[model samples]
Target: MNYVSKMLGAPDISVTLARAAARRVYGHSNRTNPRAVPTSHRYRVEEVPPALPRALFDTHFAPLTERLPSVTYEMQRYLRRAASLRLAELISGGTWRQCATALAIPENSARQTLNVLGRAFAPDSLWPIFENVVDHIAQELDESDARVDYVKRRRLMAQWHLPADHHYAMCQDLRKLRTLREQSNPSPIEVLVWSAVTEAEYLHSPILRALRLSAEGGGRSLTLSIHRLVRPTSPVGGSLRLRPTD
Candidate 1:
């Protein structure tokens, strides 16, 4: 969708104006601009609350399995893998990581393994669990580098004249989310967004990228879901998809 369309759907004029102001700064000459320029208005996903992994497994993944036998089997595989990983983490801190007493595995190796799992065996949904042993296995919740990186990105956005509130509003969500994995607790919203966006190669806006998630089935056409957060009041989502590849 076009920028005007994205603005038109904003909750209010203030948000729309904030978005506009930020866009203007990002629209500067790409060659001269050091910051990444969003080529489109990225989808904004809704926020989810934090919850335990077993609770998440039941709430998020268990239901889908009921609808199809194939789904059930696939989910079972993911659970077993999670159980094994959790055990490994508990017993030896996972295959890549060191024992609880020593330094952990290289971030590169851990990230590579996460990437392989995500693209292939990563379940369509996850069972969020907090056991102190495997909570960190998910990796999305322990994003110190990502968080710091976005801080710099947001600073550039503001330095070029973007509204502080607009950026802060986003940072608040990111801050809350990055910390969710310490307990292996995640809201359904978090699982959904993480499943869709973790391996995305490109996004229109780096800070705003989590708001947009890439959706598709294995061997299925892709779709882009854009949404607004329901805020402290509730999570009755308002959704739009742009040029869905149906």
Candidate 2:
């Protein structure tokens, strides 16, 4: 799927252009020569509402843990083993910080433990829930320290149960969504909504019922078209070869 082909085929581009757009946004070396670059043309599509992103987050991303019981349970196991505390306690005020301070586990030791735990159990999908937890932890940290804390929590999650390349795929999806927004003339919020709904559908998320109802009330064809535009051709993380062999 080349960029031109994607632009021609659908009003909303797929990951190919998304990656290119990401490079354009984040990888450009010549900021002084902003005019040197060529921008994507706008397509006059249906207006995406401004409130879409918030609606999608509330509808799809927030309650992600509820859809994956097994993953949640595995997460609980790792949290307990790492902190010797329940999930609630780990999330409780000052407790996680205290645990981290008390253990003072070296990065190497933490990595090894995560690898061992990740290999101990195989779950169908882990990254989403892992990411959710990291975001949750980052919420408590200062903006300046949030990135550092996010990295630490991300490492812990990846070491514990995340499948290889899962994070990469997730990152690509985010970049793709951003790219799609840039290339199109839709509202930023609407682009987020499109990304969220398509992602929810791809994940078989619990919000499908809500989406279906929304579609039924609105128009079925529009929903179908939206799916065609942004839905991933491949599974988000590819094959989940989670279990390790001796």
Candidate 3:
């Protein structure tokens, strides 16, 4: 019985010594080699501005009042003619490269022109008349595949580069224009016609002014007269006739 108790006590003593030695070694190692400790992150709190009134917010950011400046009509007509010419060039020639050369424009310029036309004559707008021109050109060409490919490529390019928010802003502007026109009690047709006219003027006024300035600076006098006639009663109604005189 005494020998068994001594054996048990010996094993316990060995375990206690082993634990003590391990503790000493660990403590010594920690003292000699301190590890890097991560610092706690600090955050800053900022005060936000007070919310603006809903009406004021809408007026400033998403205004529902769009007025067409007087020049848009002439600009629209010019753009339409230019669009038609571009489409004709694209369809008559097999390749845009040849068309660009014939038109004395760079390939990139031609592509940009087409992109602008596409946006201007969007399907949802009151420009379906121009769509027929595109359809005619597409049909006249034996290369339907080419037309489809061009559309796909153009769409991809637009998606990749065009600002998505600008379109939304334009839509908001249109809504505002409609609201303003309705409140004014003017016929929407007249408003649209006037808007189109103003759009042209807006585009051309700067050019015209620059031209006049150049003439003045060069010691040459210039006289310019523009007459615009709207024939709402003609067989082809709602047509704007522009005559420029020197």
Best-performing candidate as measured by lDDT? 2
Kindly provide the TM-score of model 3 when superposed on the true structure, using C-alpha atoms: 0.23
Clashes of each: 6, 1, 16
Q: Rate the local accuracy (lDDT) of all candidates.
A: 0.29, 0.31, 0.30
* Candidate 1 C-alpha lDDT tens digits along 88-198: 333332232221112112334333433433343323322222222233333333432322222233334422322445434534646533333232222323323432332
- The number of residue pairs in model 2 that clash at the backbone is 1
TM-score of each: 0.18, 0.21, 0.23
Candidate 2 lDDT score at position 133: 50
Q: Model 3: residues >4 Å from true position, as ranges?
A: 1-81, 84-87, 90-97, 106-108, 123-128, 131-246
- Candidate 1 ranges beyond 4 A from true positions: 1-72, 96-127, 130-246
Q: What overall lDDT, based on C-alpha atoms, would model 3 receive against the true structure? A: 0.30
Q: lDDT of model 1 at residue 68?
A: 38
RMSD of each: 23.9, 25.5, 31.3
Rate residue 19 of model 1 by lDDT.
Answer: 30
Rank ordering of all candidates by TM-score, starting from the highest: 3, 2, 1
Model 2 weakest 10-residue run by lDDT: 43-52
